[model samples]
Target chain A: MPALVVQWIVALVMLVGAFFILLASIGLLRMPDLFLRMSATSKAGTLGAGLLLVGTIVHFWDFSITTRTVATIIFLLLTSPVAAHLIARAAYFDGVPLWEGTRRDDLRGHYHTSTHTLDSVVRPAPDTEIPEMEGDDFPEEG
Target chain B: MMLDVLWSAILVMLSAAFVLAFIRLVRGPRLPDRVIALDLLTIVVMGFIIVYAVRSGQAAFLDVAIILALISFVGTAAFAYYIERRV
Candidate 1:
């Protein structure tokens, strides 16, 4: 590719990635509670870093750089969600407060308060009855 | 020319994010909040290091980025474990 084209692509990708990072930070600041902030940072921060890595690959375009960047990307994708999960679990066990409007927490009834472990017997109740057929009351007109 | 412009623009934005993350780090109501803020700050710093590597045309700095990312995740997970289990 031409130098100008590569530079333009890099600029655009970096711009978008940087914007996501900025948004993550803003969300971190504005969110009401720890869970929401975790959501923002985990998703947006990982995406932004991925985008920036893409930009780096485009700009550098070397054998070693490509390998390292791909490794970094994989590492990021694998770990971020797990990290978020662990943190959220810890927060829940620590009784970190949820946002006011937050309604249904399925885990509330499932987790053992003393042991901090989710119990298997406490599953969510399934929908018992399907809605009655709306238009099936009438027999075939034949 | 375009790369230069993009670099400055992104640098400015990331710096702003860094400052906001710092505020969260400092003004936390709980330990978990502080941990989250530290995680965010580490991510932003990783971004900064990656950007610097790109700007300077250095592949070595990417190693730093990789190490930083891995270490930050481990740190976050360890903190989570600490919060969950005291020992």
Candidate 2:
């Protein structure tokens, strides 16, 4: 009876995980922009993978396998958000256009292309003039 | 008996998901779109590896899944860096 119950639980967990993964892939296909796709895939993909790892732990009921499964889950959870953020920030700076339906973009006009800096507030114009350095501050030319 | 059927169904669903993600990878109009598709593909492949490990009763394969996850994260980060640094 216990074995039967375990089987059912594992099956249910795997089914749900697989469904979530499939939903993420579908979202990746259907989303209108890179950011939207990242939003869909990163969250759903991590959850799905984590759930599947949990199912593996339950199915095996072994100590080493459980440890590895937990490690994989933790790593996925830790890295997925960072990876998504990096990709999205890069994509935005690389000029990947947003969807037409996107109503607001707070980062627009605040990002300095040359310096790769972001200002908290949009400046009237990017300061192109280099402030004159004092004699002591300026390095001597070779 | 039922467990066999369920596993097979899950595998099929994952394969379909992989196909859909691959379609996006192929049809991408921009590099980021392709990168996102590749990331999704790695995720789907990870799920596939985990499911196979469960089905085959080979705990060894779980290691492969873990390594794959690590590699995918590294690959995504590298691609992001490349995109950011592009002239």
Q: What DockQ results do all the predictions give, each relative to the true complex?
A: 0.66, 0.73
In the range A19-134, model 1's lDDT, one tens digit per residue, is 99999999999999899999999999999999999999999888888998999999999999999999899888777767766654556557665667678676433522222333
Q: What RMSD, rounded to one decimal, does every model reach?
A: 7.9, 10.3
lDDT of 2 by residue, A90-136 (tens): 98878787776665666766877776789888763554332233344
Give lDDT tens digits, candidate 2, residues B5-60. Answer: 89888998899899999999999888988998998899899999999888778889
* Model 1 lDDT per residue over B30-78, tens place: 8888898898898899989988887777778989899999899999999
TM-score of 2: 0.90
lDDT of 2 at A34: 83
Q: Candidate 2: what is its chain A TM-score?
A: 0.84
Candidate 2 residue pairs in backbone clash:
none
TM-score result, candidate 1: 0.87
Candidate 2, superposed: residue stretches over 4 Å from native: A124-142
Evaluate residue A138 in candidate 2 and report its C-alpha lDDT on the 0 to 100 scale.
Answer: 35
| TM-score per model (chain B) | 0.91, 0.93
